[model samples]
Target: MENQQNDVKYEEEYIKNSRGVELFTCRWVPLNTEPKALIFLCHGYGMECSITMKGCAGRLVKAGYEVHGIDCEGHGKSSGLLGLISNFDN
Candidate 1:
């Protein structure tokens, strides 16, 4: 889905990872100009990208950067046992 906040555009999607788990991903991009750079956001443990890091993403977008984030396996909207990392290989 897509939405606009001020001059930034926000979008979210779900994609299956290599392990076949559906992961939630989101991005914020400057709507009126080419982004200066790309920023990949990494949320803390037990934190999800959309809600937890939204403000940070917005700030970056306003600074002329595109920000992307993801809810890792077993966290947030991702499909897996909550709080379980198992292994990082996947």
Candidate 2:
């Protein structure tokens, strides 16, 4: 448990879906050599899941889980901005 907190591997700004409005983007931080589980978080609209999610993710990570996130369409670095995301599936 304590050891897991020490090991953190992250791949930031990775793409999930990239059509018109990609519905996902995340900071993948591997918390352990052998994670017990994977934690995925989808944030609120008009906002990315990087700030507070980082804190929550860190705690889960320390508990030996692979922490990940998705910034629903019109949010983070996924793709399209708000007020312009057509009828695309995000």
Candidate 3:
């Protein structure tokens, strides 16, 4: 577990959609190793990906997979009204 934690690499960033709302994003990957696969995770409504998805993401990274997560609009550090999804199509 300690070795896995030391080998894990994580990053957080933000991206804007067409509507210019910033969405919080994160990535977890193993250091000095090529990922075997990629997994994208979306947190539940009213939850932030950073908090809700960290455990799973860490495990995946430790297993040599790249894990990514994004906080939808209105959640986490994303720009929008809390607990609201402005558009289902977005």
Regions more than 4 Å wrong, model 1: 88-90
How many clashing pairs does model 3 include?
0
Q: Each prediction's TM-score against the native?
A: 0.94, 0.68, 0.88
Q: What is the lDDT of residue 13 in candidate 3?
A: 89
Clashing residue pairs found in predicted model 3? none
Error of 2 at 14 (Å): 3.3
In candidate 2, list every pair of residues with a backbone clash. none
Best by TM-score: 1
How many angstroms is residue 89 displaced in model 2 relative to the true structure, after the best TM-score fit? 8.4
- Candidate numbers sorted by TM-score from highest down: 1, 3, 2
lDDT by residue (32-90, candidate 1, tens digit) is 99999999999888878999999889888888999999998888888899889777784
Q: Write the per-residue lDDT of candidate 3 for residues 1-90, one digit (tens) a residue.
A: 123457887788889999898988988878889999999998888999887888888888888899988998899989899999667885
The pairs that clash in candidate 1 are none
TM-score of 2: 0.68
